[model samples]
Target chain A: MAAATESFTDQAIEVAGLKVRVMQGGRGSPVVVLHHSTGGPGWIPLFERLSAQHTVVAPDMPGYGQSERPEWAREPRDLAILMNAAIDRLGLTGVTLVGLGFGGFVAAEMATMNPSRLKALVLVGAPGLQPEEGEIADQMMVDYEDYVKAGFRDEAAYTAVFGETAAQDIKTLWDFSREMTARLTWKPYMFNRRLAPLLKEVRTPTLIVWGEKDAVVPPACGRQYKRALPNARLEVVAGAGHLVELEEADRVAKLIAAHAAQA
Target chain B: MFIGYFTERPYQDPSSGYFGATGRDLTDLGMSNASYDPRLGAELYNRYLDEKVYAEEMGFDGLMLNEHHSTPFCMGGVMNVEAAILARITKKAKIVLLGNVLPIWDDPLWLAEELAEIDMISRGRLVTGWVRGTGRESVAHNAQPPFNWERFQEAHDFVVAAWTRPGPFRWEGEHYNYRYVNPWSRPYQQPHPPIWIPGVMSRNTVAWAAKHRYPYVMLATELEPTRQSYQYYDDQAKENGYESGTQNRGYLFKVHVDETEELAEAAARKYIQGPSNPFLEGNQGNVRPFIQNLPGLTSRTNLLPTVQSFALAASRGRLKEHEAATGKKAEAATASADKQDAADFLGTFTDQINKMSIITGTPKTVIPKVRHVLEYLRPGSIFFWDGDGAMTHEDSMRSLRLMGEEVIPAVREMGKSLDLSSPFEVDPRTNQPVA
Candidate 1:
């Protein structure tokens, strides 16, 4: 993996009348990093690692973090459409698209809708497919604090992201993120029922990453995703829960960098 | 002061341990259908209906009904049906649906139509209410909690439009989308039936109710907190350039009358065994601190602390008094530690009766206390909660007869003397025009 720290600058861009905050870092081929349901920790260590080898364009999805949630952005497809417009407006073609958890579902939608926009696709502990065996946890029903706890393998990992006490601003951001997830994933519950079937249409070389002890999405979900996609590789990171990117940032960055380089 | 009769119509079979050791049977989403006894349920429904009918005859101004899902706490899963039935059965008392859970209703048009039919059937005696229901209700019905508020507002707007505005219109709300919105039957009351909202001091609700100029019914809340809630509503109303008063506020109370105060205390204990506080796990009217308020349901303004203070408030008042006298908390107070002192300090039968939390006495004793509550709250309306838990049908009817004969008459006179005007009296337009 490249250096763990890289300088990043925040920029706001208009896409379909919605303001999207994108964190741009390093200098190379663009790797659009889509955040999970918890939104962004702004420029994190994972982004730092990804930025060392490749230009990391991490945009806060509409209704998450700093992005404006349009009234029309009611579903995952709406988010996908907004994202597609955002990439096109930013002129980031042949981009390696990376998404985690809820964002992975949006990424899958984007790939299915417009596969040509991406050079490769990476999904880390995504929840767009429900396995017949283990079910995805109902993130909406649980308290925000509990949901945060469920994301990491240890409490120390939580403190790393949220410090000792999550300040009011961070708490508000999480609330907004949770609300957005509810809006998008509530009806079908974290997955589009048709997403599994739709995965076949995504010709982009896909990489599915699973946290070995993921209680939230479960490893079984990764298997289902692997079986459903036409051309995909599945890699499981040990000793990590749902927040694999944060827990094993260097390992995840290596996997993504290798996958994108091979593509 | 307008007084109404209310019951949760609880299925009174506490023998089953389906409620589990914690006594939080209702909050356990898995234990819903297990605890329900249809045989007992059928009897309870008719018996509760009978009690309400007798309450109307007892000169109560309204017959209050509320809805809750997947719990033995309230059998009015569909309160509108009961309201429709009571519309034909009762002659005078207004049928107040304290409300329908707005977010859970997939079709607001159907609700509007049903409410309209009930209003027409009762000759314009419907006081419509809408509520963002409990977290348990959301879990039971799978109504998404995040959309709870939006759905409530949208459904309310749609229902109101269905009644007031010429329909066959379009509604493209964020939560609800209807291409052709129309209802065949309009409400009997001209600008639609009066809107009442019941809440447990959610400041947002108080502000919303005040802005809309609707009556805010404080649901079985503590006296001082309820006064503050009413004042909050008044403050919001003043911001919108309206002077809200007793007419714009209401309170629900658990009241049961018996031959003696001791018997009334026994009945109050039985009340704790049922929906009133049974599923709440012995917390009698104090909502379980951990589970009652869901995240995102309440405002950031001391929501959790406020809910936690129910314990502090209950403890500070009765339990503290008990502690000071008995040298132990109510829970720790033993039988040998002066039963009378314990009763006075703890939420014992005598203690509750003394505190006026559960008004239980002969008509002579109960009337004065009822008047005191009426004077204190000075509500536009009061809901006389007559039955729940194991309180027998005969006992409930007896209480009603006593209330009709004595308690209500005295309360009405007290209302007159205190210069308290009900919403119905102040806003006569809510009443149906006589044919």
Candidate 2:
């Protein structure tokens, strides 16, 4: 068993014959963090908070960050299968999966594939289910910067994380991440039509977290997730956007921790 | 030389305030369909078609058409439909499509049938061309951007195989899958019509064209860089175990000739005035970088010379807008020296004329400039881009007449002297001196 640590370290682990870049820290019961379409936020404050009590493993979801891209992987389901393989290879048991936005879709898919493998699932501003109200915001229609900024509650929150102007390296990474997202989620524009029915079978205890002011993924998606999952409750974070985890890290982490512990 | 007449078939309406001098500097893709007046569209479409028929009568070897989507800059969103019209309307002129946007089509088999029918209708006067298309096409058509190149290659292969090969073969490619690949309409041209590839700054496309020994047509790029681009094609061809010649190269440039130089200049200036095109410099000058450069559409590393020049200009345009809004110069660090050079290069209309990017004059004056280009690039095919950017039908007719009467004869003599033979005259694939 890995010892509980304050800081995270990156390790290149092989899963499904592809090099997956995993950022791991802390140790106890396992919790894997799946990232959004703009790739993993890389041990953000939310992950750091969770790392205090849980073995947090955040891999850069293949074809994103430093992870090797598999040409065969097209949709979120393909990524879910690879992530399941990754969990199996890491020897994780009674895992509590945390997915943010697009990552939530992958986590939900993982839970559906093997409900017994997961102890709890936390979906933050996730967009797997189609909202009954407004649609999931089309990322392709707007500028990349605008799309990223749309995730935050306001400019201050965005500036705090990404500074005044994103560095060229960050821009490059965002472009790469967007390309991967486009590849996987272009046709349906985020949600799978079958995901709602698939989620009905995911019996894992679930927490559907959403930002009250989310402009990217509709807040109604949280309710949709709750309705889809048999044993799930919706928690809306006030004064936050789609990236609720980044905006209100402590609150989200507390909710996730409580859910994981209870499960 | 294969002298072809081309136009974008612009949907021009001056009253809409979407085009011309003093119009809003709207981005190319941002132009709304609300501005499109179908009454004007009806008049313009037929007028353009009439001009094409006249071009054949005036001695053009080919009538060229191109496609763009969701923009008023080009009304040929479904250009193959126009090609089908030309196949029936015109005689003794190759109905050249430069060309169908391959990546946008969900099924290339439909396109194969469409083109094959056009070829059969025209009795083998179809010079088929394919373009990977720009970011606008991908977005407007809802085509996958990351898989654009892959889809383009697959679609091209599928279309060619459908045309040449016998029916009912299975095609199991990544982007496209078919249980049975069969189309009743085979192309009229033996082994399918000649495939020509046109591009702006994509080196991958240029290399691909060279590898396949397809005629690589440089579209209104600057003279020096265009020569270098053709040289790159030549080098690629040599590496691919073949010697490239004039037949393997083509150049399309804006050339408007009038009875007088002043009239020609006035008409030529309209090229930048009508329906703001992001691709055209000194026009709208508002190229949304995100829209133009969709993620993974074109590789950043393998860019040609013009891309840097264009990028610099686009960035400078953005900086100018920033300054106008904020009342302050942007950070000096962002204003790199390359951008300064591009700012100077994308200068006034006179500067463009001096650069030979836009050649306009009386036939006698324009012929010498045309001679200079022919001598420099040695292209076997030349497309005179006329009647576009809000140019009146009368303006286009005059230019076409002058080109056919004076320019074409002179250029043909120049081609003879330069030993330039078009792809039709000398087959690009077999490297036959005269077909």
Candidate 3:
């Protein structure tokens, strides 16, 4: 409805009395990307690939990036409500949903809470269930330097998160994102005990994408997601960590695009 | 003036040491469980308990106890239990639990029951205190650090309601919930026992104490900061439309006495190994900062400056030690900076006592210094810690006897001369708000 570049258009929308910043681009079917817990950096290279084929809609989750955090959205379910309202407000039906890390948890909640509108669901290195053997790395507790190091497959990919500008404001935004993520995920600690049972209600075609070496959420969690969901397939990307989408953007994007094409 | 006696009830015998085997410091969290030899611990607990019971006979108005987790520096893994034991063991002295760690408790109602029972048994002699435990406690309990303050506030509210308000009421707060919010036991004190809060000058805690009219106890913190923190509490109380006095404030310090100054200094030096060394050894990667101050635990702006000050203080102490060891005197221009750094690291126990107003002398010399600190701070109560580190039970008993005969009476006279009356002495709770 507003002026847009061929590649992308950045704007804001009000849903549930909170200002939610969203980046929209390209032309065709609508596909939304739910971001990770440590948010704020939007329109990454992977989103650029998705923009070439589909009308990609990436809304910065409330309390991260440029979005406002209303008091009601303190819990994970509150986030699911905001996502549902955002999707319904955008007038998008039968849409493909993409989630990464903290975003994956929110997307799964959205599917379970309101299963009618989603056409396809894609989860990348998502953290929502616990494993019997290995523990999900307590991402919230590590020091700053260790946190950055553990997020990527190779240390070189750290620049992708900081971006070329690498200003103090980016660090501040990242800190806020961490705080908001803690508010939502600290109690259940990155996994919901009830989430496994609720996955049975997710009837939409689903894709569970995992990194070969995800330290934050173990690859075993992806297997659990696949087994729990009624209609889902697991795909593992080689030589990447928890942020698989950022580390191997081209391949990860292609996989999601192919899934969207099938839908 | 009300006087209280305290000891950390430390397990200091290192013959069967856990930290030494792990190559970690005495305060290391990893060595917590194994730090104490149970046979020695059983003996130490009884000895300490006997010492506290004797202190009641020594004219101390209150007997103070504290809680800590995963460290031999304090064996108050559960201090309320000690309070319960003391409630029946002693008759006259107020059984002061200063206090239960609020955030670590899974259920606030259980705490209400414990406190109520203590009050009922002690026949209204319970001075209930509450605290937000150290980051180490949070780690030991695996409690969420981000919710520490929130849980503390919620649990406090719930416990107070359970004690005072008629129950069968439901609670649905952010951190706690109850379907049947009621406990059968009620406290012996009308409404509830006097709530006291002890802190090293955390601004929010001090301010909250002021708002609720809870006596704020400054524990072994530096003199100047304690002064500033007391002023902050007073200022906050004024803003809330109330007047605060000496009774509203309390101060704790290490006070050792003997026949001569040499004996007193010799005993006080033992504290260097316990509380002083831990501050110098620093965090030592034992408990991560993230585990201590989680994101969203406090207002963001306050977190960084507080953390920076703590780091700066620790480094400054190390720098001073380095200078002293190498005989490298700082230049005149940098001397002021060094002094500022030294001032920042004030929690080191020996430095706090020696530099602040920790009186270590015979009653003749000690009285004047005690008078000076009391005159300057004008607090409602003073807690004299007679035992820590390698100090034996016999040594602690002698100090208690000396305090009973000489120190307490002299300090009372000095407080009277200075016209320093405590809030309890004034009894402001019954007075209606000024119209």
Best by DockQ: 2
As for model 1, its CA RMSD to the true structure in angstroms is 6.6
The lDDT, on a scale of 0 to 1, for candidate 2 is: 0.85
Q: List each candidate's DockQ score.
A: 0.23, 0.68, 0.39
Question: What is the lDDT ranking, best to worst?
Answer: 2, 1, 3
Candidate 3 global CA lDDT score: 0.75
Please identify which of the two predictions, 2 or 3, would achieve the higher lDDT against the true structure.
2
Q: What lDDT score goes with residue B350 in model 1?
A: 47
Docking class of 3: acceptable
Please give, for residues A1-263, the per-residue lDDT of candidate 3 as tens digits: 11223468889999988999988987778889998777846567887778888889999888888899865455777898898999998999889999988899889989998888899999998887877548777766665445656778867776656554345455556556777877777766888887889999888999999999888888998999998999999999888888888788899999999998886
Query: Which segments of model 2 are wrong by more than 4 Å?
Result: A1-6, B22-25, B307-309, B312-341
Docking class of 2: medium
Fnat of candidates, each listed: 0.25, 0.67, 0.50
- Taking candidate 3, what TM-score does its chain B reach relative to the real chain B? 0.86
Q: Candidate 1: where are CA atoms >4 Å away?
A: A1-6, A152-173, A238-240, B18-30, B165-174, B179-182, B239-241, B277-357, B428-435
Q: For residues A172-244, could you state the per-residue lDDT of candidate 1 as single tens digits?
A: 5666677677667777778778778888887789999999888888788898888888989999988898998
For candidate 1, write residues B315-432 as lDDT tens digits.
Answer: 2122343333223344533335434433432455544555666777788888888888877878978998877766778778878888888888888888889977778778622323
TM-score of chain A of each: 0.95, 0.96, 0.93
Give the alpha carbon lDDT tens digit for every residue of B1-435 in model 2.
899999998888888877666557567676678777889999989999999999999899999999999888888999999999999988789988998999999988899999999999999999999998877899999898888899999999999999888888999998888999888889998898888998877889999999999999999888877888899999999999999999999999989999998899989988877773557766654666676777778765555656333453243233343333223344442445345335534556787788887899999899999999999999999999998786899999999999888999998999999989999889989898653
**TM-scores for all candidates?**
0.85, 0.95, 0.86
